[model samples]
Target chain A: MSAGTDTRSVTRQVRPGESPAGPAAGPGKTPFSARLRRDWPLLVMAAPMLLLVTAFWWIPALGNVIAFQDYNPFTGGILGSPIIGFTNFAELFGDPQFLRAVVNTLGITAFQLVFYFPVPIALALLLNSVVSGKLRAFIQGVVYLPHFFSWVLVVAIFQQMFGGAGLIAQILRDHGYSGIDWMTNSDTFILLVTAETVWKDAGWGTIVFLAALSTIDQNLYEAAAVDGARRWRRMWHITLPGLRPVIVLLLILRLGDALNVGFEQFMLQRSAVGSKVSEVFDTFVYWSGLRTGDFGYGAAAGLFKGLVGLVLILVANKVAHALGERGVYSRS
Target chain B: MSRKKVSGLAPWEEPGSVAGRIGKGGVLALIVLAVLLPLYTIVLTSLSPAETVNRVGGLVLVPDGITFDAYRQIFSDSVVSRAVLVSTGVTLVGTAISLGVSVLGAYALSRPGTLFHRPMLFCVLLMFVFFPGLIPTYLMVTSLGLKDSYWSLILPSAVSAFNVVVLRAFFMNIPHELLDSARIDGAGEFRILWRIVLPLSKAVTAVIGLFYAVGYWNAWFNAMLYIDDTRKWPLALVLRSYVVDSNPLPTATVGVNGFGHVAPPTLAIKMAIVSIAVLPALLIYPFVQRHFTKGVIIGAIKG
Candidate 1:
């Protein structure tokens, strides 16, 4: 994603009169002061953004140093704190609660990958197949509505419809059947969360896939039809192949984000199902770091998760490159 | 149902066998029902009379009578009313600041050969891979003494890197010849950006602005983390605490004059809060829905 955007702009920068050597090479050709004079307006425009990013993004990044320190709010600041090396990490790996959180995180991620990932692809195909524009638009709007809702709202809606005293339970009681405890059931917590996620995002997620489907050459489908390809066969061959690159790109991105199985969703429902089931890395970090005031320990767990995410993204990008696709970033 | 001829149906697309048509129709119906049923229930329950809501014991599927008591009660409450104001203020201010920063930065970064452009773009893109984890971010906010301030919410998320990249992509796609001609005609970069680029990029800018607004509106976590003062909380956070946390509505002491007679059911109140939280998005969504696909697709395909 990053590399693709950069390369486009880089190519665009190559003017007719300019040297073939790009902007990076231009620094050597022209004097620094001369270039600065010419680029001052753009620099001035970007200054606020640069300052904001430096404060929010870069400074917090530097604050990751606390992960390696015995961080205390009262006495030692981030850098002033005594270095603790990987002791916090060692403690994190040793803690049963942390292990449980890890297991839960992976479990949710895996479930989402298996069950939730293909849903949007399937939904997009279904929407794509609809010949009626009005029906398609209506369905699209309805589905996308849930995506705009906050997780708290989504969970509340689920509870309203499925909780012990919820609509479904009330209906079942009217028919002399007992109400089910699906909403607060720890055993089914993972499945419930996954279902909620699908309900919320599956339709919205189809936007990109649908866009990809639209870009497929219509002539290929017509030619396939002339060659006697059935609807199912055409979809399997022509349509699926056309969507493969996007599917791969999305898959890599999903894998990179596999560990972040949402904080708010789990946090909101944690009391209902208990932390034993609902606790994930994000909530775990929150509980240990902020809520419990174990900043160093929580920072360590968070840092560990961040590092894993970075490595996963890099590895995913490398795999994408091996598959002859541009990953998130290019080497250039 | 009458079968209307479908436009944009490819020549290769079959009319489909009877079974296939029925199957597709059934699946589509199921998908639509899955989405609409919960929304219907929420709205119905919110509007249902207290007696009907009590009888239902949860969400009212069918309304015996309509009552705006729940809405009146919630709106009249000091806490909720204050929360609404906070949310509105945060969303408007945050969106404006975000749009301003994003527009200026995107324009600067869009021109590739500008000094520090490559490095700035690289810095922005790095956000895609590495996140400064939650603890440090919280520490930073606290250390900066923005722990209880609204600026904490606005500042932390002031500039979305994805939006910036997407906006830059849109800027880059603006015909260079037009910009060049304007430049030759003595129009400065700012003038060209404001007068020409922004005017032409209305669709994209509007969509990105909507995205920022929605994000700010739906945001509760930042407020929950930073703003320890309950009165300063936004609607989403209030909604979460009141509805999801199942806290009883802090009875309105001041504005309960007319609402005192009609004691709405708990379910009705919960649904009403949910509706209030969602109402703004639903109101503006139709107007902006068309741009959703265009905006997201551009970002996905290019960025």
Candidate 2:
């Protein structure tokens, strides 16, 4: 890919109609034809990625038209399928399983927001307070290790420690208590998954907050301390306020990603706990739509999730701006 | 409180009182223990003898005896060995291709006033807001004749817009005068990129490459969705089936004919598989650990 781009750029520069003088191109006022001639090499460099993104990202986006069609893969996919405006969505809305999935997604997302979100902030604060740099780095390294492990490995680790025949269960059994099926327990599965997420990601998440914390001016803390402010007072008045924008930015991003309550995690555990308790929107779309050959319905469910996420992000960004914070992207 | 000067402490930081020191120590100890204990159990259990593992009922925290039987059994099994090869191949090839495409695209996009620059930037940034739903993406993959192919795993996720954006930001930060000097010397865009831009941005490129490699290595979802043939499955998918899903490892038919009758303890095998899945990440983690904060901060703050 690199060689191809390199060759193309070199070849383009050697072509006719080349103006060798640099910056005399008059910036944005350059003629479109002249700019194209001069900059075609850059365009050539970008072509492969442009083609890939268009083919994969944009085409699939257009394929969302399947949600409005009774899409049968055998019947020529989206374009070939009969039009069924809102029927798939109506079915999705009417389906109890789909509703269950929506509820489960919301529940898991809420649990994560409430329980898992603050962990990194707390960890960052704790680590920030540490006087010894080496000790802090060591702790960060150890904690961050789990974040790289796949959900499969993480789930396996959790099962080994907590499953019916796992370490904890064996200890209980040895103490004359019956083993509990913690791994597959539906009633507590949400908690289990959330705990797993925290274990896997909390330490990794602290990196950004730690960065943000370090950027907080030392003079602010010094100024506060000069006024006879205590540690807790400084934290509340200076530290917390400094972290507020980042916290809000992350929170908004989290809300936008709420619909994605981890498909693979739930999919791997679904048969163990049964989908009745484990069905989040992603899994629901997979099982009901793709697996069952109900492509249109699955497309509708996924489309709904995506649209909600898009709206959530937009609203969150708007809210961030209202609060005088820079959201994810600027309007410009 | 005496306003005593303290060396090596920040202005707002307390010189640890005895109670405060003890409290910090306790918290750090808990954090360390929470992470280390589970890892210890996994390693110990993988090394423990079958009888010891069975005797303990599951994960062995304290091994009475050690054995490599589980590891030996898994490697000797064709399914697992093949899956390992598949994963390594996919990760290497996928990372290389992803990095190549990303570098080219990022370099181009980083240059201000390049043809279609704003629209291209807008398109990539818009990826942050919405994703094409699962079914459509799957359909697109199938329609492209990539279904059941390894390309399905690599292609769909080949270009991460975030990585491109991050790399673009890094490339843009490169001084224009350096590139202009090269350009004045008749060095083309490609030559300047190869000799100057790449060498200068090695750290960010490496970080982005690692991200791509990790993503590919850890991905089983694409395989699960695309590849139907069990033989073509990657190590992660196999690991998920045998370990996470609690399914028994498929008995090897060729190498150890009588091994089916006397299999290792299920728990030991599961632990071994778990360890195997995590081993690569653990091995490479230390080398890349320092870059995590640097790379992530660049992406987060800039993007």
Top TM-score model: 1
Model 1, residue B220: displacement in angstroms?
1.4
Candidate 2 stretches with Cα past 4 Å from truth are A1-28, A322-332, B1-7, B10-13, B252-263, B298-303
- Tens digits of per-residue lDDT for model 1, B138-216: 8888888998899998989998887887777778777687887887798887898999999988878887898899889
How well does candidate 2 score on lDDT at residue A111?
85
Chain A TM-scores for all candidates read 0.89, 0.87
lDDT tens digits, residue span B16-58, model 2: 6867767877997898888889889998898887678777777
- Alpha-carbon deviation at B71 in model 2, angstroms: 1.5
Per-residue lDDT over A89-117 for candidate 2, one digit per residue giving the tens place of the 0 to 100 score: 99888999999998998998898788888
Worst 10 residues of 2 chain B by lDDT: B252-261
Off by over 4 Å in 1: A1-25, A324-332, B6-12, B252-260, B299-303
Candidate 1 per-residue lDDT, tens place, A118-208, comes to 9989999999888777778988988888888888889988998788988788889999999997888999998899989998888888877
In Å, residue B177's CA in model 1 sits off its true spot by 1.4
